[model samples]
Target: MAAIYQVDSFTKLPFSGNPAGVYISDVEQDYETCIKIAREMNLSETAFPVRTTDDNHYRLRWFTPTTEVPMCGHATLATSWVHFTELGIDGDIYYETLSGQLKVSRIGDDLKMDFPSELPFRIDLDQSIGEALDCNGMAYYSTGTRKLLFEISDRKKLEGLHPDFSKMEKLSVGVPLRGLIVTCKGDGEFDFFSRYFAPWVGINEDPVTGSAHTVLGPFWSERLGKDKLRAYQASQRGGEIRLEILDGNRISIIGNAVTVIRGQMLV
Candidate 1:
């Protein structure tokens, strides 16, 4: 029997964060089976725990309903929560991912993830990408993923702005992956608020993306002149994150996890 645990990552309380389905098994499933199960689960992402060098260390792979993603921090955090809190695995847990080794540590009520940094490079804003999104924005940039970072003259523009999904899908085809639209100094609660659209990758909007923060957090921290910052994903189903810029190559992302559902699956 395989056990499936439903957990909400990046929020301490249940029903408040990104929910992920985690599958634990003694034997790892083939790639096709993993993708099939992930599609069936139909969560933002599903994590599979594979054999590792030690019991405390394991390999994890993340699959969206449509395809496999290289890495996912929120799902990784949820995976850690299930292993540590439910399965009673103690200490820092190590996961070998396609993106490389990731370390997760439990600190009090928050789970901190040590992940690699994805720095954004400067790019010119042009009408081509804008036409692709069919939204008016002032500026843009590109992280590992294409980004539309615009400064709104008025915050009200944010509340009323909507992009054409068809245009966004067209824009995504031009770029290697989907693009993210972010507004700086628009929300008073946090440094910035963002909406991720990746139709190419099968996600319209991710509730809270910890991996994306691997790029956004440090970018804001350096600009804000503070090592630590608070982030909010302004999706209808909102989520929050506490980010700290560590050494040049690493970052510490702090968020709480909530276990929403627990069940067993026959494999």
Candidate 2:
């Protein structure tokens, strides 16, 4: 049996943010077991944290319903929330992940995650992809994570996007990446607005993605000419993120999470 918690990350209210499964245990589960658990949970991502040599440090791994990923922001925030609120652990917590060492700390009511920034490089916008996204002539870029990022001029266009998931999946197959980020300039309270789609990774649309903002922070910083910005993910279940660009290609992502469900997974 394993303790499983369903947490809503990136929002203070429930059902408005990304929900992730967090599994906390002293023993590290096998790869197949983790995959199975993730499949059973069937969320966008599930996190497994196992204790390491240091009490404050742990090894973290993230999994989608279909595959494992190197990094995941919402799930990591959920993990930290579980540790802080459920397990009575506080202060800074370190995680060893495939993306390398990461840190999360509590600042007031929000948990601030120190993540490596990913600056995007310009790429030619493909016509087929534009057609699939229903927006053409959008600027396209790629990051080290291999996710495709594009920008639209109108926030309404970005919000009204109804991408063809099947077309997106076919186009992304065998491309070493599955996620696409579509962003636009914000209107009122937000500096920018965006959405994420990753049909190839078994997620059609992520409600609020923290990992995507690692690239967005730098990409928008250069365009908006600000080091700190507030972003909004315009999904059906909307969420917000506070971003701060740091030196050495690092970014601080700040958001709030709430544990919505707690149960024991009997396996």
- As for candidate 1, its clashing pairs are 11-256
Residues 203-231, candidate 1, lDDT per residue (tens digit)?
A: 87777888878777767776788888888
Judged by lDDT against the true structure, how good is candidate 2? Answer: 0.90
Superposed model 1: Cα runs more than 4 Å off: 132-134, 138-156, 172-175, 178-181, 186-188
Worst 10 residues of 2 by lDDT: 169-178
| Estimated TM-score for each candidate | 0.90, 0.96
Clash pairs for candidate 2: none
lDDT of 1: 0.76
lDDT of 2 by residue, 1-267 (tens): 889999999999988899999997888988899999999998999999998999789999999988889889999999999998999887799999998899999988899999998888766656767888888645455556768888878788888899998888777323467589999988769999999998878899999999999999999999989999999999999999999999999999999999899999988
Total backbone clashes of candidate 2, pairs 3 or more residues apart or in separate chains: 0
The top-ranked prediction according to lDDT is 2
Which candidate leads in TM-score?
A: 2
Error of 2 at 221 (Å): 0.4
